[model samples]
Target: MKFISVTTADGLKIIINLTKKIWPVAYGKILTMAQLDYMIDKFYNETALLELIDKGHVFYLAQDDNNNYVGFVSYELNSEPNKTKIHKIYVLPETQGTGLGRQFFELVKEKAIENHQKAIFLNVNKYNNAIHFYTKLGFTKVKDEVIDIGNGYVMDDYVMEVDILQ
Candidate 1:
Protein backbone atom coordinates (compact mmCIF):
# COMPACT_ATOMS: atom_id res chain seq x y z
CA MET A 1 0.00 0.00 0.00
CA LYS A 2 0.98 3.62 -0.51
CA PHE A 3 0.00 6.74 1.36
CA ILE A 4 -0.63 10.14 -0.14
CA SER A 5 -0.61 13.49 1.59
CA VAL A 6 -4.05 15.02 1.20
CA THR A 7 -3.88 18.74 0.49
CA THR A 8 -5.46 19.39 -2.86
CA ALA A 9 -9.05 19.77 -3.94
CA ASP A 10 -8.93 16.31 -5.49
CA GLY A 11 -7.54 14.81 -2.33
CA LEU A 12 -10.32 16.24 -0.23
CA LYS A 13 -12.80 14.80 -2.70
CA ILE A 14 -11.31 11.35 -2.27
CA ILE A 15 -11.65 11.62 1.49
CA ILE A 16 -15.28 12.57 1.09
CA ASN A 17 -15.99 9.74 -1.30
CA LEU A 18 -14.24 7.21 0.91
CA THR A 19 -16.14 8.40 3.98
CA LYS A 20 -19.42 7.90 2.13
CA LYS A 21 -18.49 4.33 1.39
CA ILE A 22 -17.07 3.55 4.82
CA TRP A 23 -19.51 5.24 7.16
CA PRO A 24 -22.68 3.28 6.51
CA VAL A 25 -20.95 0.00 7.11
CA ALA A 26 -19.00 1.37 10.05
CA TYR A 27 -21.82 3.18 11.79
CA GLY A 28 -25.00 1.75 10.31
CA LYS A 29 -26.02 -0.22 13.35
CA ILE A 30 -24.76 2.20 15.97
CA LEU A 31 -26.50 5.29 14.61
CA THR A 32 -29.76 6.02 12.90
CA MET A 33 -29.55 6.74 9.19
CA ALA A 34 -30.64 10.29 9.74
CA GLN A 35 -27.85 10.84 12.25
CA LEU A 36 -25.38 9.19 9.93
CA ASP A 37 -26.32 11.45 7.04
CA TYR A 38 -26.20 14.50 9.26
CA MET A 39 -22.76 13.70 10.62
CA ILE A 40 -21.41 13.08 7.15
CA ASP A 41 -22.74 16.37 5.87
CA LYS A 42 -21.54 18.13 8.99
CA PHE A 43 -17.99 16.80 8.96
CA TYR A 44 -17.13 15.41 5.58
CA ASN A 45 -18.12 18.35 3.48
CA GLU A 46 -15.36 20.21 1.68
CA THR A 47 -15.74 23.30 3.83
CA ALA A 48 -15.50 21.39 7.07
CA LEU A 49 -12.50 19.37 5.92
CA LEU A 50 -10.78 22.52 4.74
CA GLU A 51 -11.34 24.10 8.13
CA LEU A 52 -9.70 21.13 9.79
CA ILE A 53 -6.68 21.60 7.54
CA ASP A 54 -6.59 25.29 8.42
CA LYS A 55 -6.45 24.26 12.05
CA GLY A 56 -3.35 22.14 11.50
CA HIS A 57 -4.81 18.75 10.72
CA VAL A 58 -2.84 16.56 8.32
CA PHE A 59 -4.71 14.12 6.13
CA TYR A 60 -3.41 10.98 4.48
CA LEU A 61 -5.04 8.64 2.02
CA ALA A 62 -3.96 5.02 1.75
CA GLN A 63 -3.90 3.44 -1.68
CA ASP A 64 -3.60 -0.17 -2.66
CA ASP A 65 -1.08 -1.64 -5.10
CA ASN A 66 -3.62 -1.23 -7.87
CA ASN A 67 -3.93 2.46 -7.06
CA ASN A 68 -7.33 2.44 -5.42
CA TYR A 69 -7.96 4.41 -2.29
CA VAL A 70 -8.59 2.12 0.66
CA GLY A 71 -8.43 4.43 3.67
CA PHE A 72 -7.64 7.82 5.14
CA VAL A 73 -6.48 9.37 8.41
CA SER A 74 -5.96 12.87 9.74
CA TYR A 75 -4.02 14.00 12.79
CA GLU A 76 -2.73 17.19 14.33
CA LEU A 77 0.61 17.46 16.06
CA ASN A 78 0.89 19.17 19.44
CA SER A 79 -2.89 19.17 19.56
CA GLU A 80 -2.62 19.16 23.33
CA PRO A 81 0.86 20.18 24.32
CA ASN A 82 3.17 17.35 23.31
CA LYS A 83 0.34 15.13 22.22
CA THR A 84 -1.07 14.43 18.78
CA LYS A 85 -4.78 14.18 18.19
CA ILE A 86 -6.08 11.76 15.65
CA HIS A 87 -9.01 13.62 14.24
CA LYS A 88 -10.19 11.01 11.76
CA ILE A 89 -9.26 7.51 10.68
CA TYR A 90 -11.27 5.23 8.48
CA VAL A 91 -10.72 2.38 6.03
CA LEU A 92 -12.96 0.75 3.48
CA PRO A 93 -14.92 -2.06 5.06
CA GLU A 94 -13.44 -4.54 2.66
CA THR A 95 -9.98 -3.64 3.98
CA GLN A 96 -10.90 -3.64 7.66
CA GLY A 97 -8.93 -6.70 8.82
CA THR A 98 -6.03 -6.27 6.45
CA GLY A 99 -3.80 -4.09 8.67
CA LEU A 100 -4.61 -0.91 6.69
CA GLY A 101 -5.97 0.75 9.79
CA ARG A 102 -2.95 -0.28 11.81
CA GLN A 103 -0.62 1.04 9.15
CA PHE A 104 -2.44 4.36 9.17
CA PHE A 105 -2.01 4.44 12.95
CA GLU A 106 1.65 3.48 12.77
CA LEU A 107 2.23 6.33 10.37
CA VAL A 108 0.71 8.71 12.88
CA LYS A 109 2.94 7.21 15.57
CA GLU A 110 5.96 7.80 13.39
CA LYS A 111 5.01 11.40 12.68
CA ALA A 112 4.25 12.13 16.33
CA ILE A 113 7.67 10.88 17.38
CA GLU A 114 9.34 12.93 14.71
CA ASN A 115 7.49 15.98 15.99
CA HIS A 116 8.60 15.16 19.55
CA GLN A 117 5.11 14.39 20.72
CA LYS A 118 4.76 12.03 23.67
CA ALA A 119 1.44 10.43 22.96
CA ILE A 120 -1.38 10.16 20.43
CA PHE A 121 -5.06 10.18 21.21
CA LEU A 122 -8.38 9.71 19.44
CA ASN A 123 -12.07 9.54 20.20
CA VAL A 124 -14.00 6.40 19.42
CA ASN A 125 -17.72 5.86 19.77
CA LYS A 126 -18.32 4.07 23.05
CA TYR A 127 -20.13 1.27 21.27
CA ASN A 128 -17.91 1.12 18.22
CA ASN A 129 -16.01 -2.13 17.75
CA ALA A 130 -12.86 -0.19 16.86
CA ILE A 131 -12.25 0.31 20.57
CA HIS A 132 -10.92 -3.23 20.66
CA PHE A 133 -8.65 -2.45 17.77
CA TYR A 134 -7.31 0.64 19.51
CA THR A 135 -6.70 -1.40 22.61
CA LYS A 136 -4.65 -3.80 20.57
CA LEU A 137 -2.52 -0.86 19.48
CA GLY A 138 -1.70 -0.07 23.14
CA PHE A 139 -4.29 2.63 23.74
CA THR A 140 -6.15 2.80 27.02
CA LYS A 141 -9.31 4.70 27.73
CA VAL A 142 -8.53 8.02 29.35
CA LYS A 143 -11.90 9.66 29.57
CA ASP A 144 -15.42 9.72 28.22
CA GLU A 145 -16.97 12.55 26.27
CA VAL A 146 -20.26 13.49 24.72
CA ILE A 147 -19.94 15.86 21.82
CA ASP A 148 -23.03 17.43 20.36
CA ILE A 149 -22.46 17.53 16.65
CA GLY A 150 -25.70 19.35 16.02
CA ASN A 151 -28.93 18.08 14.46
CA GLY A 152 -29.72 16.22 17.67
CA TYR A 153 -26.73 13.96 17.33
CA VAL A 154 -24.24 13.43 20.07
CA MET A 155 -21.06 11.45 19.78
CA ASP A 156 -20.79 9.49 22.98
CA ASP A 157 -17.18 8.50 22.90
CA TYR A 158 -14.27 7.27 24.92
CA VAL A 159 -11.04 9.18 24.61
CA MET A 160 -8.17 6.71 24.18
CA GLU A 161 -4.45 7.33 24.22
CA VAL A 162 -1.16 5.51 23.81
CA ASP A 163 2.24 6.77 24.83
CA ILE A 164 4.96 6.71 22.23
CA LEU A 165 8.11 4.87 23.25
CA GLN A 166 11.37 6.58 22.51
Candidate 2:
Protein backbone atom coordinates (compact mmCIF):
# COMPACT_ATOMS: atom_id res chain seq x y z
CA MET A 1 0.00 0.00 0.00
CA LYS A 2 1.05 3.57 -0.59
CA PHE A 3 0.47 6.55 1.68
CA ILE A 4 -0.22 9.72 -0.24
CA SER A 5 -0.03 13.14 1.34
CA VAL A 6 -3.28 15.00 0.86
CA THR A 7 -2.50 18.62 -0.05
CA THR A 8 -5.02 19.64 -2.66
CA ALA A 9 -8.73 19.92 -3.28
CA ASP A 10 -8.72 16.61 -5.15
CA GLY A 11 -7.15 14.82 -2.19
CA LEU A 12 -9.60 16.33 0.27
CA LYS A 13 -12.41 15.15 -1.94
CA ILE A 14 -11.02 11.64 -1.78
CA ILE A 15 -10.98 11.73 2.00
CA ILE A 16 -14.55 12.97 2.03
CA ASN A 17 -15.63 10.13 -0.18
CA LEU A 18 -13.89 7.56 2.00
CA THR A 19 -15.55 8.97 5.12
CA LYS A 20 -18.98 8.47 3.59
CA LYS A 21 -18.15 4.81 3.07
CA ILE A 22 -16.43 4.17 6.38
CA TRP A 23 -18.30 6.23 8.99
CA PRO A 24 -21.66 4.47 8.91
CA VAL A 25 -20.02 1.09 9.39
CA ALA A 26 -17.49 2.33 11.92
CA TYR A 27 -19.95 4.26 14.09
CA GLY A 28 -23.31 2.64 13.37
CA LYS A 29 -23.33 0.39 16.39
CA ILE A 30 -22.56 3.04 18.98
CA LEU A 31 -24.21 6.05 17.40
CA THR A 32 -27.73 6.79 16.31
CA MET A 33 -28.28 7.36 12.62
CA ALA A 34 -29.11 11.03 13.14
CA GLN A 35 -26.04 11.59 15.27
CA LEU A 36 -23.86 9.76 12.78
CA ASP A 37 -25.04 11.82 9.86
CA TYR A 38 -24.72 15.04 11.79
CA MET A 39 -21.15 14.35 12.81
CA ILE A 40 -20.20 13.44 9.27
CA ASP A 41 -21.49 16.69 7.86
CA LYS A 42 -19.96 18.67 10.65
CA PHE A 43 -16.45 17.31 10.32
CA TYR A 44 -16.02 15.77 6.90
CA ASN A 45 -17.14 18.59 4.66
CA GLU A 46 -14.54 20.10 2.36
CA THR A 47 -14.67 23.45 4.13
CA ALA A 48 -14.20 21.92 7.55
CA LEU A 49 -11.43 19.60 6.41
CA LEU A 50 -9.63 22.43 4.69
CA GLU A 51 -9.86 24.52 7.84
CA LEU A 52 -8.30 21.65 9.76
CA ILE A 53 -5.45 21.45 7.29
CA ASP A 54 -4.91 25.15 7.63
CA LYS A 55 -4.74 24.64 11.38
CA GLY A 56 -1.97 22.08 10.92
CA HIS A 57 -3.80 18.81 10.33
CA VAL A 58 -1.91 16.64 7.85
CA PHE A 59 -3.91 14.01 5.96
CA TYR A 60 -2.70 10.89 4.19
CA LEU A 61 -4.57 8.51 1.95
CA ALA A 62 -3.68 4.83 1.95
CA GLN A 63 -3.87 3.31 -1.49
CA ASP A 64 -3.76 -0.43 -2.06
CA ASP A 65 -1.57 -2.25 -4.59
CA ASN A 66 -4.49 -2.27 -7.00
CA ASN A 67 -4.74 1.54 -6.68
CA ASN A 68 -7.83 1.63 -4.49
CA TYR A 69 -7.94 4.29 -1.81
CA VAL A 70 -8.67 1.98 1.09
CA GLY A 71 -8.12 4.26 4.07
CA PHE A 72 -7.03 7.65 5.40
CA VAL A 73 -5.52 9.27 8.49
CA SER A 74 -4.86 12.86 9.63
CA TYR A 75 -2.59 14.07 12.40
CA GLU A 76 -1.28 17.29 13.92
CA LEU A 77 2.27 17.65 15.07
CA ASN A 78 2.92 19.47 18.40
CA SER A 79 -0.71 19.32 19.37
CA GLU A 80 0.46 19.01 22.97
CA PRO A 81 3.88 20.59 22.87
CA ASN A 82 5.72 17.28 22.68
CA LYS A 83 2.98 15.07 21.29
CA THR A 84 1.08 14.57 18.05
CA LYS A 85 -2.66 14.31 17.75
CA ILE A 86 -4.42 11.84 15.44
CA HIS A 87 -7.40 13.81 14.18
CA LYS A 88 -9.00 11.10 12.06
CA ILE A 89 -8.38 7.56 10.81
CA TYR A 90 -10.55 5.01 9.05
CA VAL A 91 -10.20 2.06 6.72
CA LEU A 92 -12.90 0.40 4.65
CA PRO A 93 -14.71 -2.28 6.66
CA GLU A 94 -13.25 -5.02 4.47
CA THR A 95 -9.76 -3.67 5.10
CA GLN A 96 -10.11 -3.68 8.88
CA GLY A 97 -8.15 -6.85 9.65
CA THR A 98 -5.67 -6.59 6.82
CA GLY A 99 -3.11 -4.58 8.83
CA LEU A 100 -4.07 -1.29 7.16
CA GLY A 101 -5.14 0.23 10.45
CA ARG A 102 -1.83 -0.59 12.07
CA GLN A 103 -0.08 0.71 9.02
CA PHE A 104 -1.92 3.99 9.47
CA PHE A 105 -0.84 4.20 13.08
CA GLU A 106 2.71 3.40 12.12
CA LEU A 107 2.52 6.14 9.53
CA VAL A 108 1.58 8.61 12.25
CA LYS A 109 4.22 7.19 14.58
CA GLU A 110 7.01 7.75 12.11
CA LYS A 111 5.97 11.35 11.51
CA ALA A 112 5.63 12.04 15.20
CA ILE A 113 9.18 10.89 15.84
CA GLU A 114 10.49 12.99 12.98
CA ASN A 115 8.71 16.02 14.44
CA HIS A 116 10.39 15.45 17.81
CA GLN A 117 7.13 14.53 19.46
CA LYS A 118 7.35 12.23 22.42
CA ALA A 119 3.90 10.69 22.01
CA ILE A 120 0.75 10.52 19.92
CA PHE A 121 -2.88 10.61 21.00
CA LEU A 122 -6.46 10.47 19.79
CA ASN A 123 -9.97 10.43 21.14
CA VAL A 124 -12.03 7.29 20.62
CA ASN A 125 -15.69 6.95 21.45
CA LYS A 126 -16.03 5.22 24.80
CA TYR A 127 -18.43 2.59 23.54
CA ASN A 128 -16.53 1.99 20.31
CA ASN A 129 -14.86 -1.40 19.96
CA ALA A 130 -11.81 -0.05 18.15
CA ILE A 131 -10.52 0.65 21.64
CA HIS A 132 -9.27 -2.93 21.54
CA PHE A 133 -7.33 -2.31 18.35
CA TYR A 134 -5.79 0.73 20.04
CA THR A 135 -5.00 -1.19 23.23
CA LYS A 136 -3.14 -3.82 21.26
CA LEU A 137 -1.01 -1.01 19.86
CA GLY A 138 0.16 0.02 23.38
CA PHE A 139 -2.14 3.00 23.89
CA THR A 140 -3.41 3.50 27.42
CA LYS A 141 -6.49 5.46 28.31
CA VAL A 142 -5.22 8.74 29.69
CA LYS A 143 -8.61 10.25 30.43
CA ASP A 144 -12.26 10.44 29.50
CA GLU A 145 -14.05 13.45 28.02
CA VAL A 146 -17.53 14.54 27.07
CA ILE A 147 -17.48 16.98 24.17
CA ASP A 148 -20.62 18.78 23.15
CA ILE A 149 -20.64 18.82 19.36
CA GLY A 150 -23.93 20.72 19.05
CA ASN A 151 -27.31 19.38 17.83
CA GLY A 152 -28.04 17.73 21.17
CA TYR A 153 -25.14 15.30 20.79
CA VAL A 154 -22.02 14.78 22.83
CA MET A 155 -18.95 12.69 22.24
CA ASP A 156 -18.14 10.59 25.27
CA ASP A 157 -14.63 9.46 24.51
CA TYR A 158 -11.46 8.15 26.02
CA VAL A 159 -8.26 10.04 25.37
CA MET A 160 -5.79 7.35 24.46
CA GLU A 161 -2.05 7.81 24.12
CA VAL A 162 1.08 5.88 23.19
CA ASP A 163 4.66 7.00 23.59
CA ILE A 164 6.56 7.40 20.34
CA LEU A 165 9.94 8.51 21.59
CA GLN A 166 10.54 5.37 23.55
Clashes of each: 0, 0
Residue 138 lDDT (model 2): 96
Where does candidate 2 clash, by residue pair? none
The best candidate in terms of TM-score:
1
Q: Model 2, stretches more than 4 Å misplaced?
A: none
TM-score for each prediction?
Answer: 0.98, 0.97
TM-score of 1: 0.98
The CA lDDT at 70 in model 1 is 93
Worst 10-residue lDDT window for candidate 2 reads 107-116
Model 1, stretches more than 4 Å misplaced? none
Can you write out model 1's per-residue Cα lDDT over 1-166, one digit (the tens) per residue?
9999998778999999999999999999999999999999988989989989998999999999999999999999999999999999999999899999899999999999999999999999999999999999999999999998887789999999999998
**CA lDDT of every candidate:** 0.95, 0.93
Question: In candidate 1, how many Å is residue 115 off?
Answer: 0.6
Measured on C-alpha atoms, candidate 1 has an lDDT of 0.95
lDDT of 2 by residue, 1-166 (tens): 9999998889999999999999899888889999999998898888998999899999999999999999999999999899999989899999899999999999899888887899999999999888999999999999999999998999999999998756
